[model samples]
Target: GKDKPTYNPKKERGDVVVVLNAAHVHLTHDKWNTKLYRWHTGYPGGLRSRTAREQWEADPTELIRNAVNGMLPKNKSREARLEKLKIFPESEHPFEGFPLVPFLPKPRLLQDRGLGWALPQHLALVRWCPPSLLLTPRGPGLGAAAQGFEPANPERYRFRLRTSPGLQGGAGRPVVGIEDLLTEEERRALAAAGQQGV
Candidate 1:
């Protein structure tokens, strides 16, 4: 009959130890919520269950330890082997006394910026103006208009609704209808009393 390997805390087993940075470990999908850990006490009706997220939040080190322990052989030395594994929430560890090597994780990029689709390279972001201000006759693009400040491709952000050049009364003046300069009553009286008896 084969005998179970006895666990020895002092004995150095030729096994590889892996220490993962819990913060850097990226879990995929809903595994954090769906994956569960079930354990039973030695007594009857002592079943217990916990989600990976719950286990992690409660004790991050325990989650990794449980996962790794389950994968190893269920031998007497399993507990001894698990003692070698270590998981840390941060990149730093207290094993500086030993010759420790660093593990570099690959950088992951977002597949999309969530803007739906690509915008033209010439596009410029313009600040929004309220519709009330836009409805005014002397709104942004009217006479003597100051172009709004823009970052990156300022020219592309120009407001093309500028008053037509023909609408200008003079070099820098906007055209004003004659009615604008006269009141309705004055205009009517002036028209009726025109020229002393021409």
Candidate 2:
């Protein structure tokens, strides 16, 4: 077994996580009905309570915040770590100026839960290139003829894989529809971007 690492109060534990479309979060089984969120208003007989479903409908972002906060260790640095977690009820966020990477959950996990795929509609517009393709010279190497036809700015080229809303999985597999995969906000975003579905 490896040795236990020492705790460093000054060291940062992880990077900031920005979660979008928090309203679309799904609760397994009957958790939405059974789970309860209780709090007091700091007044006499000011106790208030609501079910997970009620709370989620009232404030979608709060569910994600509570979930993440519950998982963090109860320590002096808990508040600092919690602050790094940013959750948005809708898909729109103000972090466009920053270089952000799309985090895709494992296909198996989604498939197991019959959730299909969840991805931002704008991510399809992001320009990306394989490191090998970027490094390859326009010479008679692998696929040389194709390499010769290079754009002035290779990074400017965008690659998109469009999936039709009506598309279905293989035989006996679950029929994952656009309505199942994308939230209403994301669907609208896709429409604004001129893409049918992703």
Candidate 3:
């Protein structure tokens, strides 16, 4: 745990102190091989990594700390928490001399990047909002709901009414639904693509 700093909980307004046990951390699939842990000693390429397993052997606690951290919101508290964390290969930590308490990992659902934008109707909603694509009736409907309109499932909302009340009578045009959801997945795939931009 010497890899991290120790702090006092009694000093509520100051920095924090976290003691970690590296031996029992978990990591997703082959991230150990592909994940790169790079750093710099104010010199050239000081990048580093221990192939998950290697890191486990070197400092088991850091591996877990890093895995959990990557899932957190990138912000001030994120940085602070990392600063206070102290990883140890064994249960016996140097932080024992400080206000040491067991650190519990938060149980967070790993939302697929494709599904990150929930509220399926968000796109429809956005298009319907003050500005953007939904500005038009998305093939019909003028801020007015059709017969069985359910806001919860944008798929239930149909927009086949005529643009002009007396026009060709709302014809069937695509109103984005499950099929449209696929594009989100496609976006994620592209996002995960490599070196060259797709």
Q: Give the best candidate by TM-score.
A: 2
Model 1 steric clash pairs = none
Q: Model 1: residues >4 Å from true position, as ranges?
A: 1-12, 15-20, 103-198
List the candidates ranked by TM-score, beginning with the highest. Answer: 2, 1, 3
lDDT of 3 by residue, 1-198 (tens): 323355443332444554433564433334445566755677567655446556656666766677668975676656666766555654465555776443322222223246434333312322222111122223322343233333444543233222222122222311222122224443334223311221
Score candidate 1 by lDDT: 0.47
Clashing pairs for predicted structure model 2, backbone only: none
| lDDT sort, best first | 2, 1, 3
Find the 10 residues in a row with the least total lDDT in model 1. Answer: 130-139
TM-score of 2: 0.49
Worst 10 residues of 2 by lDDT: 132-141
Please give the distance, in angstroms, between residue 60's alpha carbon in candidate 1 and its true position after superposition. 1.1
Question: Which candidate gets the maximum lDDT versus the true structure?
Answer: 2
What are the per-residue Cα lDDT tens digits for candidate 1 across 113-159? 55656432211221222221111112223222233423344454343
Report the lDDT tens digits of candidate 2 across residue range 79-110. Answer: 99888888987668999898876553221111
Q: Report lDDT (CA) for all predictions.
A: 0.47, 0.53, 0.41
